[model samples]
Target: MQQSNTYIIVFTAILTIILGGLLSLANQGLKPMQDKSIEIDTKKQILGAVVDVSEMSNQQILDYYNGTIKSIVVDYNGELIETDEKGSPIVAEEVNIPKNFKQQPEDRQYPVFIYHAEGNDDAVEAYILPMYGTGLWGPIWGYVALETDLNTIKGAVFDHETETPGLGARITEKEVQQRFENKQIYDENGNLESVYMLKGESNPESALDEHHINGMSGATITGKGLSDMLKSYFSYYQGYIEKVKSEKSVASL
Candidate 1:
């Protein structure tokens, strides 16, 4: 009886060790695939902000991003910075948005992605900006695509970590996002009045109409958070936008 009990304990120990080793090995083998999946998902989100990528395959998304997107890093003074030895701007994808957001606005390295539509020689189709904010449940983030004029919104795509399914999560819905289309971020006086999600329905003909969009009914807090996020990020990009406008004005003269 004593010998049998000892053997049972030894067997249990060996089994536990074997199982632990196998689990570790599995995790190690899957790490590369997991990282690849995350990379693909991020690329898809970025592209979706500028164009319709819902039907696009992984390869197609990657191809489109690599072919047409030009990434530029700019400073608070609106000056282009962080170039390589060849004097080319660093790739925007390499800029860590979350980390940069944590830094002071002027100290942050902002990533701007310029998209060129097919056959449009040297002209920018849209500029994509990254935004992050807290939601009811957790972190909510997205990308906003601006037209060349820098004041008009061309498109937007949002995603959240743990927002309520039917409420705050609706921000990711097509209809909700479509409301931002053609929205103006700046007022006629050239003031930065960032676009906002109103608590109730917006009056299209109202003076503040260009800056307002209808908010989700049951998600007022989430809507406010989204509005604040857009305002803060747009303010950060103001310097670069102003620089671009000035350059264009000079070129036209």
Candidate 2:
């Protein structure tokens, strides 16, 4: 009886080891594919902020991104710090927004993507800024595309890690996102009052207001999260916006 028990224990231990080894091997083999899937998804999200990418093929997305988008890394002072040998801005897609979010805004490397519309002689149509923040459940992140004026939103695309379905998750809905279109980030006095997601229905008269949007029902926390996220990111990019405005003013003179 003692020998039989020993054998049973040995068999169970061997089976466990074998299963663990197999699982480890599977994970190692899948890591590259997983990384690639994440990369493609991120590109899709970035492109979606500017154009309709819902029906775009993966190759098409890559082609459009490579051809029309120029990425740059900037400092808090709105100075371009990283550039290629030819004096072109390097692609800043690898700037890692989530990691940078934890650092002081001055210390963070901001990634900005300039989208040039086709047949427009390479004129920048919009600037895309990446944003990250906390939601009720987990991390919420997205991209906001600003018009060339740098003060109005062209479009926005948001995604959450673990928001509750039908509630906080509604922030990802198209209708909710479309509400951001044409929203102004600055006030009449030229103050940088970034757009906010209100707690409930905003005043209809204020619908044309530049700084507020009606909040989602039953998702007050999430709405606040979105508002906070937009404000924080817009502030980070404020330096660049100011620099562009200054340059435009000088050019016009």
- Per-candidate Cα RMSD to the true structure, in Å, reads 3.8, 3.3
lDDT of each: 0.87, 0.88
Predicted structure 1: clash tally: 0
Q: Which stretches of model 1 miss by more than 4 angstroms?
A: 1-23, 83-89, 119-121, 200-208
Q: Model 1, 248: alpha-carbon shift in Å?
A: 0.8
Q: Give candidate 1's error at residue 238 in angstroms.
A: 0.6
lDDT at residue 96 of model 1 (Cα atoms): 79
**Candidate 1 lDDT, 1-253, residue by residue in tens:** 3568879999999999999999999999999999888888988888888888989999998888888787788888889888856876676787777777788998888888888865453778999998888878888899999999999999999999888898999989989998999999999999999888877545455634778888888888899989999998999989999999999899889
Number of the top lDDT candidate: 2
Pairs clashing within candidate 1: none
Query: How does candidate 1 fare on TM-score?
Result: 0.86
Show where candidate 2 strays beyond 4 Å: 1-15, 83-91, 119-121, 201-208
Q: In candidate 2, which residue pairs get closer than 3 Å at backbone N, Cα or C atoms, i.e. clash?
A: none
In candidate 2, what are the lDDT values of residues 1-253, reduced to their tens digit? Answer: 3578889999999999999999999999999999988888988888889899999888888888888888888889899978645886655887778888889999888888888875452599999999999999899999999998898899999999999999999988888999899999998888889998877755476564678888888889999999999998898899999998999899889
